[model samples]
Each structure stands twice: as C-alpha cells, then as structure tokens.
Target: MKDVNFIFIREKIASSYLYFISFLGLITITISLLEIKIPSHSTILILLLIFMGIAEYFPVRFWRGTSSLTFPIIYAMSWQFGIHITIIAIVLVTLIIHLHRRSPIQRMLFNSTQHALSLILAEWFSNKCMHLLINNIDMSVLYENLISLLLFCVFFCFFNNRFYDLLMILLPQPYSIYQWYKKTVTVFLCETFGFSYAALMHVLISKYSVEVNEITVLFFFFPLVAISVISSFSVRIRMEKERLYELFLITTEISRGLTGGNLKHIKQALKGFFGIQAYGIWTKDDGNWNLLLKDGKVHFDISDHSEKFEGISKNLVFNDWKTGTAPGDEIFDSVIRSLVYFPLIVNDELVGMFVAGKSRTAGFFPEDVQSLATFSNQLANVVKTRILISEQEKRMILEERNRIAREIHDGIAQTLAGVIYQLESAQKKYRDKPIDMQQIVEKSIKDLRGSLGEVRYSIYALKPYPTQQLGLKQAIASKIKSLKQEYELDITYHERGHARALSFSKERAIFDTLQESLQNIVKHAQADKTDVLLSYQSEHVLLRVKDNGVGFSLFESMVKTKNEPHYGILHMNEQAEQLGATLQIDSSVGKGTEITLLIPDSQTRGA
Candidate 1:
C-alpha cells in the first residue's frame, strides 16, 4: 500500500512539474511581448529560434535520439511566423545530413545551423507578409513577434525534461494509458485551480484600484504546492497497481505452462514467468544434480556443488532462501542470489529439484514465493504419476519374462531331457552288440531329431510369426500339430464357424493359454484322447481344450496347502487377463479336464 502511494505521489509531482515549466515559459513569452521598446523582427525571430532549439534538446535526449527537432521547428514556423514551405525544406535537408553524421558533436553543430537558417527564413517571410497585410499598423510586427515567442514557449514546455521523463517512465510500464490519463487530469485540475485562484486574487487586489498585493501573490503559491502533491500521489498509485497486476499475470501464466511431461515447456514457462537472470531444473541421480533444463543458453558450472547434491536424496533445503538470491554459503554466493531448490516428489520419494536463481531483479516476494511452491507441488504430482505408471509397466514386463522362463523349463527343457535319457539308454545297448549296428544308428538318429524338434518348437513359441502371415486358425493348428508330434498324444483338432485373423495380442494370448492347457493335459490328464476346438460366435472367439484324462478337482487342487504348486491355471488366467479375454476351467474326480478361453469377436476381427 505504501509503495502504491509512493508511485502515486511521484506521478502527481511529475505532472505538476510539467505545468510549472509551462507557466515559466508563458511568463517568459509574456514579458517579451510586453517589452517597452519594439525589438527588430530579426531579433525576435532569433530569440524564438533559440528557445525552440532549447526545447528540442529535452525531447531529443528523452527519446534518446535527434529526431525530435522536427516537432519544434514545424510548430514554430507554420503556426507562429507563417513560414511553412521554405523553412520545412531547409529543416528536412539539414536533419538528413545531421543523421548521416557519425559523431554527436557533428550532429549538434548541424542542428544549430538548421535552427539559425530556419529563423532567417521565418523573419524574411514575416517581414514581406507584414507590409501586404497591414499598411499603417506596426501592430502586425508586434503581433507576429509576440505570437512567435508564445509558440516557442509552448513548444518548449511540451518537450520539457519533466514532461518527457514522466512519459518515458510510464510508457513501457503496464497500464500506461490509465496512468497517462490520471496524470493528465491531475495536471489539468492544478493548472485550472491555480489560474482561477490567481485571477480571483488579481481581482481582489485591484478592487480598490491598487497594484497586486503580497497577500495575493502568497495566495497563488498554495495551488502550485497543492498541484505538486496531488500529481505525485496519483502517479505513484497507478504505477504500483500496474506492477502488482503484472506480477499476478506472470505467476498465472507460469503455473499453467509448466506441466511436467515436456522439460522444454517447463523451462520456457519459467523463463517468461520470472524474467530471471538464470534458472534450471536438475534431476537428482545417485545423489548428483544433473541439469535437465535451462533458460536461455547459459552454461552452469556444477562441478563445485556436485558433491553436495550427490548424496542429498530429498530436495536441498535452504532456509530463508528465495528464487534468485545468491546462496548464503561462500561457494555458491558468487554466481547466484538466493537459490530455491524444490524437490520434484513422486509417490513420497524425491525425483528431482526445480533449482532457480534470481539476478535481474530482487529475490521473489512472499506472493511469488508462495506461487513457486504451488507450481512445484503441481510439477511433483505430474512427475509422480508418470513414475508410477512407468514402474507398473516395468513390473508387468518382468512378470512376462518369468512366465516365459517357466514355460521353457516345464515344456521344451523337460522334453529335451527325456530325449537325452532315451539316447543314453540306446547308446549303452548299442555298445554291447555289433550285429545290430544299423538299428542302434536309427534309434540314435530318432532321438537326436526329437531333441531338434523340441528346440525348434521352443523357438517358435518364444517368437511366433505375425497373425497376418498365417491366420489365427492356421497358427493354432500349427501349434497343435507340433504338440501332437512332440508329445505323441492322441490329439484331435476341430474348428467351427468362420475363422479369421485376430489382433496380435489376442492371438498370442490364446495360443499361449492353449499351450499351457494342453501341456497340463499331457502331464496330468491320463486320458488317451485330447480334443482342441476353435470356434467363433456372434461376439466372441472361443477355444476349448478338453481331455479324457485322470482329472483332479480344480477347486480342491487350487486350494491345496503351501507345499503344493498350481501355476498352470494361474498362468492361463493371467494370459487371458492380458489380452482382455476370459478363461474358464472345469475338472472333477474321474472326469476329464476341460479349459475354455473366450476372446471378444471384435478383437479377433481387428476391431
């Protein structure tokens, strides 16, 4: 509130200062006009030009350029002396030459020359027009001179230092139009009241037909002082309000843009929001801060603080710190102001820190600090959600690997071991007899081929061909063939309804589940015949693997105590779940085990 009042006061004072300069210029012009002796037209023109040149100086430096000379020259000649054409041409040519000059001294010298030349043109034109417009009236010379001086004074006040400074200070700040209007109103009121009071005092002093008294002069001072105070307060209030609003906008924009998925977006958002000198986000890896994002193209030196952040698991907590304040400790103090290191926490663990520095402005205020904390909290949530999803995906992958490993060990590995045992037995029998050499070779070749077949089957199981290459029906048929050949079971395959290619995931899951069910039938079901059927219904693709074997009760076996293993049914259900399918199993004492898998027909039809 005090800051706002201060800015208001400043603006009020600035506006009054401009009015005072105008009043002084008016007084100078009035005195010149009321002179006892009539000055030569040339002298009057020269004096006006000098005042115009001085007026041009303020705007020139205020604009930080030499181009403002045009405003005063054009106003003085066209309005006061009525010398538009010749004076304008000379001023244009001189301004062009002046701009082309490299040195400031040369530019100023050219400017002075142009002012003098313009004065001469104005005097010549005025002198010629005076004779034609007014024959016996020397009043023409007096009027022209007085008007020229008045115009010069007015132009001088318009380009005065106080006026230009007030404008420059307000223009680039936010809410410029409102601030300008407020200042203008304050100045208008002050000038109006001052003039009115001065007029009233003049009237009161002359009531008795006497000269203006000291009391009347003192009365005039009150309005000038009041104008200065009011203008200052108005200017200060407007500026403070504008600054606070700008800060609020910056915070809101930064918050909305700094979502955690894109590191570049976060950095860009922060840079625009804070207008800081330098800032970055660093990910904490193995106790070290790794730079992930930075504003602009600054190369930050992390060598010194590498060890400090290396083992710091949580956010590097700093007390009484701010966004850009250099670190309080000796090592980090040189390059930074206050450092705000906020941890990017996810799932109750810290992932990274939003480390920022402030150099261009003072450290963040309380509002900015609170805003930063809120932004960090939001960032942490995003980072945490992403991390959790990633971990879940990784766990799923590991589980899949384990399932594959179990399948290889139980099916292909066991089959190869049996082949090896058979070959060894055949080898011992052949070593004892020479007459049955051909039979031994045939038996050994058979055993080796069986091992090779099992190896091939394992490879195929690990990486099946695309469903498009061979339809899902053909792929399932192939797997059944391999199982029949390898296991030598009385396996029967059947298909019903229209068969079509299924989605990759659906096909893989159905094939894997079928394999597990058949393996269970071969290893556990003691029945002589096994039947596998594939069929499509209105909304689902169904696969049933049934075997007339020594079936155990699924419920009783699944509920067995700690020492028992029941991975086959669990694996089959998991595969179905993965493909968004359903699995059902039925088994009873003295009855065959029947397993059915139902996959959505839409999925199989490439929905």
Candidate 2:
C-alpha cells in the first residue's frame, strides 16, 4: 500500500519523463513552438478534431482493451497536417476521451501527451521511409502511399504501446512488469492494424471523393468496422455467460456443503465466492438470533444492543458500510467493519443475514449482489433445516435418559429394596437360629446377584442401539422373554393389526416405554400372570401391559411428590408426550394394574 500510494503520486505528477512520456512530449511541443511558427492546415485539423470527438462516442470495447476508428483517423491527420497541427488535434481528442472515461486530470494530460508524442515519431519515420524509397523520384501513387503507410504502422505501434509500457514499468502494479508486457500483445496488434487501415482509408478518400464508382473501399472498410465491433461484443457476452455458468456450479457445490450442518463449510463457501476476508451467519431461534463466526476471526466486543440490526433496507450498494442504509448498519460498521450485509430470505420473509468484507477497495459489484440474493435464501433454508435436525437429536437424547432412569427405578432399585427387607428379617431372627440366619444370608446373596444382573441390563439400556431396525412387536416380545426368564413368571405377549412404519427415534421411545412397563410389573406387581398386548389401529398404535398383582393406590403414590411418586409413570408420560401420544394408568389397592400407551399417526403427531 505504501508503494501503491507512491506510484499513485508518481503517475499524477506532471514534471518528469519518469512516470510519463507525455511530459517529455509536452516539453518537446514547447521547444518546437519557440523555434517555429504555426502550420497552415487549419481546416484538416478542425475536421480531425470533429472525427476524434465522434469516434469517442461509440468506441468499440474488445477482449483485451478498448479501441476506435479514431486511431487511424489521427494517424492520417499526423501524416498530412504535420506534427505541430496534429498534436493539437490529438490533444483535443484526449480531452474528450478523458471526459468520456471520467479520468483524473493527470491521466487526461498523460494519455493525450503520450499519443501526440507517438504520432510525431510515426509521421517523421514515414516521411523518412518515403524519401529513401523514391530513388528515381517517381513511383506509382498507390505503391508510394502503401509503402509509406506500412513503414508508418511499424513505428506507430512500437511507440504507442511501448510508451505506455514504459510508464507502467515506472509505476508499482500488483503484477509483474513481464506479465503486463505479455498481456499487451493483443493491444499492440490491434492498434497496428487499425493505424494501417486508417492510412489506406485516407488515401482512398483523397483519391476517389468525386469518382462515385471508385468508392468501393468504403464497403469493405464499413463491414470490417462492423465485424470488429460485433465480434468484440459477442466474445465479451459469451465469456460472461461462461463465467456465470461456472459460478452456478460453484454455488451448487456450496449449497450441498451447507446442508450437512457444518458452519465452516458455509463460511468458506461464502468467503471464497464473494472474495471476502470474513463472514458471519446470524440465525433466529424463538426470536433470538444466534451469531456464528469463525474462530479467532472477529473479536466479540460489541454491546448487547444487537436488536438495532433489524429491518434491512433495499437500496443500491454503497462501498463503505457507514454510508450505506442497510439494516443493522451498526453491525457492519460500528460493531465490526464489514463491506456489505447479504440478507437471508425464506418464504419471501427476511429471516437472517450474513455479512462480507470486500477483499479489494472496489467493493461488491451489482451483479454479485443479484447472484448472492438467491444464494442467501438457500443458505437460510439450510440453516433452518440444520437447526431442526440438531433439536431432534437433543430430544432423542433426553428421551433415552428418561428411559434409563425408569429402568433403574423399576428393576434394580426395587430388587435391592426387597433384599433389604429380607436382610432385616434375618437380623431380627438371627439370635433364635444360627442355621436360619446362614440360609437367609444365602437367599439374600442370590437376590443381590439377580439385582446385579438386572443392573448390568439397565446400564446396557443406556447404550446406543438401533430400535427401529428390529420391528416393535419383536422388540416387545424380546423384552417379555427376558422378564419371564429372569422372574420365572408366566408372562404372555400378543399383537393385533399391522404395525405402522415409524422413524427410528419414534420407535426407540415406544420400545423403551414398553420395556419400562414390563419391568414395573416384574418389580411391583407380585402377580402370577402378566400380559402385554400391541394393537396397531388405522390412526394410532395402542400398547397395553396388564398384571394381576398386589396393586398399589395410583393416587397415593402420585400425591407424594418428595421422591415417593412413581418415576416410571412420570418417565412413560414424558416419552408419550414426545411421540405425540398419551399414557393411561389404571390401578387400585385390590384390583390389577393396567397401563396403556396410544401413539398417533404422523399427521396427528405433527399437529
């Protein structure tokens, strides 16, 4: 940047040959004016000025650089009106060119002066070549002008391009000087061709103005000009389409990366596509936006007044954040200096945003704005989808934890309680019979081992396993088999109606709930018969677990909230709610206990 500013000052200054050949040309003009009087070709000079002005209006821009019919027109003027008059004409053209291009005064002076210097050199060489060729002092008119024009073109192209190349060498460019030289090859060729053709046109117009039939050159020249302009624009348009096609592919790849729930991919994509240094994605959840930024990229020093960034404005892009009227101007300007903010739109509503800082001083282009408008919308949807997935995972974790809690409460805890009761009885009766105490101790050891096995199984309940891959009916039957084997109870399991397809998460909740129910029967029922029924209805799946046991009062257990309430029931209810289902518990002191789980259809569940 220091070198860049130095180069800027060097190019702008007007005193030396270091930055500008134009300065040398100006000095030459002043020297020439002091030594000689003004030449007598005022009419031709005026016409050249008019032509240069007209040519400036529709200068054809090409693949490498911009050019016009003015190049040849000026070359013709330089050869005919002589160096003094031609330099004036060339300067007038430079004024119009600078005005049309909106260049600074320094650029205006440099370009105008450089072109004039090249014209003078080219004209002098052409005259010298003509004098040398005319050995006999009489040559064919066509051959004489053609030879002179050819010689003039060589000098013209060399001086014109090299002068600018020299000025470029004196300045500091981001690229190497050799790279600039390689790039200007096409520019040199185009200007050479243009200068030669204009010279021919000057000869043709001068020789055949009155002879209407001899004006055939105009036909070929006009078509050539038309083709040059048309071809230049066609190539430019085609290249732009190809660039956009590549951009589409790039953006598509970025969209795929965004869908996978990685914030880094999103940041990298947006940064590379927009050619920015940093980006921040802000998404709203329950009316609060969570800001995402790269690690160690931005210092989070802003205050909690982030609500100031609501309601972005729709306006033309402003290069500086402070000058722009985009929503959340402070976020981009005060909190963090960003070049622009691209809004994330979903369903025609502004949902979130991502900001980009320009890699260069020129800032974001309008075409870039249009492209990213569509891109931002897609990004917002990806963020929304990721949030949903993450939340589902969290709910699944919570449901699994609850299921484990219920398994511990119903199985291991109850088994230990019964063992404790037996041990108490043995302690109380130990003084009467030592043999009875030893047998009681053996019974308690057996009870404790069974409880340990159940505890191991409870721990396994917490381990991740695919519940949906195994059918719900088969899974329930497996649980009942384990219960029957462990307790030596006559437990029967049955199913009715076709099982509906459920997501893996939903099946997990249903399976865990059923397991908890069977464990409750084994621990608390103290019954001879236990039955489990799974019935899949048209709109909902119904599961029932019944036990003919010493049933406890549901109201009494539920009312005691200080740790005596049935945690198994509470867990089952939570699992049911998550599945958009209901749990029903029916029990009394003398009657059997029955528990039912009702899971609804997808549509009903969604509601």
Candidate 3:
C-alpha cells in the first residue's frame, strides 16, 4: 500500500472514532430523557463504544484486527437486553437516514433492508447464545463466555467483506488473499479467548465470590490477554509485510519505466507510488512555465496566478511553501493541502519543476521529501541526456552544411572560373590580331561551351531530383531516362512494395548515394545495360543499383587503398550510419556491381 494512502486510512479511522463517541453521547442523553434506570452492567456498552472508537482512530502498535476489541465489547454490552435493542434501533435509523440522503427512495429502501436484516441476525444470534449458556447445565457461568463468541461471529459477518476489500485494494493478489485468511483466523481465536475470560470472570465474581480464588483469576487472565496480544501482533506483522511489498513493487515499476526512457510511464508510476491527488512536471519555455506531464484531473485554473511564476527566475529552485508569503498559502485554492516542488537542474540551469500535490493526507514526511528529491534528480538526468543528443545533432548538421559548401566551391565554382579566364584571354587575342579570326573564334566558342557545361552541372546539382521532387519511384525512372540519353545504355528500373515519405535527412542521403552509385556504373562499368530496383518492405526502404559491366572485388580494393579518395563509397556509408541504416556492396571480376542501401523504418531502427 502507498504510505500516503495508509495515512489517509488512519485519519479516517480516527474521525470515525469521534463520530462513534458522539453517537454514544446521544444514546446516553436519550436514555436519561426516557427516565430509564441505567443498569451498572450497561456501562459496558459505553466502555465498548469508547474502546472501539479509540481502536479505530488511534495508530495502535498491536495488530488488533478491528475485531479483537469490537467483539468483546459488543458481547459484554449485549447482556443488557433493553440497551442492546435501543442501540440497534438507533443504528438502523441512522443507516436509513444516511442512505436516503444520497440515493433515491427505492435504492435507499433496498440498502436499508439489507442492513436491517444483518442487524436482526446479529441480535437473534446474541439472544440464542445467551439462552444456550444460561440453560440448566453444571456451568451456568458459561453464558458469559458464549457472549464473546456470538459477538465475534456477528462482527465478522458485518466486516469480513469490508476487510477483504481493503486488503485487495491495498495489496497485490497473493498477499491480499493471505492477509484475509490471517485476519479471519485471528478474529476467531481472539473471540474464543475473550469468551472464555468472560466466563471465568463470571465464575469468580458470582459462584466463587465467597472463596475469592486469586490463583484461578490469574490463570484465566494470563491466557486470555496473551491470546489477544499474540493475535494482534501477528496481524500487525502481516500488514507491515504487505505494505513493504507494495512499496517494492511501486519502486520497481518506477525504475523500469525511467530506464526505458518513457517519461509518461515514469510520471504515472510516481503518482501511483505516492498516492498523490495530482502530480506534474512544468518546464520553463521563454519566460513561461509549460506543463510537460501531469497525472489526475485538476479543477483549479493555474493561469489566474501567472504573475507569481512570471517573476520567478528560470533555473531557480522554488518549493510550494517557500515562494509564498505564508508558509502554507499559495495561489492555487483547491483540495491540495500540500505541494512539493523540485527544480529540475541540468548543466547548472533550472529546466523545470517536478511538482506533486497532496489531497487526503498531511504534507510529505522526511522520507517522502527524500524520495521526491531522488525522483527529480533522475528526471533531470533524462532531460540532460536528451538535450545532449539534440546538441550533437545540431553540430552534425552544421558540419554537413560546411562540407557541402566546400565541395560546391572546389568542384563546380573553380572549374567555371578557369573557363571564364580562358574565354576572356581568347577574346582579347581575336580583337588584337584579326588575321586568325577562325582559330580565335573556335577557341572562344570552346571555352564558352565549357563554362556553360559547368554552369549546367551546378544547376542540376542544386535542383531537386525526381526522387526528392516526387519520390524514390519517380527518381529512379528519371535516372534511367538520363542514363539512356547520355550513355545510350538501355537501363531498366523496377519498383516493388509500398512507398512512404521518409525523413528529409534520410531521403537526401539515399538520393545522393544512388546518384554516386549510378555515376560509378556509367564511368567505370563497361556494360551494355543497367538495371536498378527499388523495394519497400515492412522493416526497411531498400534501393539496389546494378550494372552488367566489369566489376572489381570490393574487399580487395578496401584492403589495397590507404588514401584512395573513393568519396562515393565513403560518403554513402557515412550517410547510411547517420540515418541509422545499412549499406551492402556486391561485386566480382567480369560481373556487374550491385550496390544495395537499406534505410530502416523507425521501428526497425532500434533493432
């Protein structure tokens, strides 16, 4: 069971005791007004009521399973037949009135009927036990002993289901069932001993009054008290065991969820573990607090007191009580009695606040405070890790941009500059010596054509290819058309499987890699035809570029080259790794090269 929930139950029991005491006072007043002669034995009824109230309200160290004291007390009072009848009637009336207030008349009547029947059975059993013990037997005093047993049965009938429900809600299946069994046995044993003690007391006070046998009283008292104490202790041990087990289970769930990087699951585990009314983590965003995760429904509008957080600096640690003028007063005016706030710090900056609220219990204790702090620390670590990963991604993007810029400047820009210089020199020579006009014109046209080719290449590199402009299917078709036109190579491109809009980074990488592979096939492979196939599977996006031409051993080339400057293969591999993909190359002498690039889907990326 959550510690907070257990505390709430404890508080409810205490409040119930006060209510019971008030009921007893009302009974006393009613009897006095009726001019009824209160029997000395009737005092047992008031004493029983008080004891039951105390047991319910106070946190007793002993396990006294609500039955131990309740049965004996009720049994002792049952001897006063008139008082028992009056109290029973009052109980029935109270139940009827309570139910009627909350439910429809028909439902209230039905519920009242059930409660009335239970009470009737209890009264009937009490009367029968009394009659049985008072029969003309050698042990007439046994009548008193029978009272405890009868009361135990009556109380068990009334509360067994309730106890079972409580355990089921608070504990896991196996432990809850075990606790229910233990409680049942404890109740039976306690009632037996209590009844025996009552019988012995009757024998001593009435039958052996003249003899005054101290030894007999001692013998009975020792065993009776021992039985009650032992039963109570056992019940307590079981409750504690169940409590600890629940705590361990909650902790395990929280740890597992956090390790798996599920912030939502972690938040839910924390809320369940602590039994808080509502909990949330608020992150700072551009001088405003934004709710990141929350558990439970909150009715109050937090925006009403936005000014409070507005002045609070980012990265500042602020507990619920600390930021307010009064220790416990805050902007929110809901059922939350206490609020714990932890500032999530990453790299010495306050990133967010882990806020948890209390509802049916007192503020967090020292242990709870420590736990909250630990949870916040773990939460901060997760946030920090995410931030670092994001930073690394940004850095990689910057580096890629710089490299692309350099490649454009070296390959295309420098070539265009050389062509421009040659054309300008030829134009000057044609103007100076009009005698060689044909040679100068041819030279100028050649240089101009070279510049135009460089410009076209640069533009083609900038334009979105068919694959990127449309999709991989169209891109492959476009590539095949270009190959047929440029090299007079009959290329057949085929596509199979479903297609999807891949991430921009992955799409760019795959397109560039395909471009390089096709270029290599045209420039190096001596083949008549080329075939490219693109396939999409459930796990990955696959692209295969092949050429029926002279192929070289991939493994041999890698081993032979130290600084081969084979940017095509190297760049392709780098892009694949960045997209969390895999690239495989297959080739052999006198055979075509089959280059395959597999970009995994999001689900397969993890694997």
User: What is each predicted model's overall lDDT from 0 to 1?
Assistant: 0.54, 0.64, 0.56
Candidates ranked by lDDT, best first? 2, 3, 1
For residues 292-399, write the lDDT of model 3, one tens digit per residue.
566653434543343344333332222222225422224333435456667677776766666676542234544556655766777666655655666798999798
> TM-score, each model?
0.36, 0.50, 0.46
Candidate 1: RMSD over Cα atoms? 17.9
User: Which candidate do you rate higher for lDDT, 1 or 3?
Assistant: 3
User: Where does model 1 exceed 4 Å of error?
Assistant: 1-261, 285-288, 300-307, 310-338, 345-349, 386-403, 430-607
Q: In model 3, which range of ten residues has the least summed lDDT? A: 56-65
Number of clashing pairs per prediction, in order: 29, 0, 3
Candidate 1, after superposition: displacement of residue 495 in Å?
Answer: 28
Point out where model 3 deviates above 4 Å.
Answer: 1-140, 147-149, 152-261, 267-271, 285-287, 300-339, 342-350, 363-370, 384-518, 522-547, 550-607
- Give, for candidate 2, the lowest lDDT window spanning 10 residues: 329-338
Best by TM-score: 2
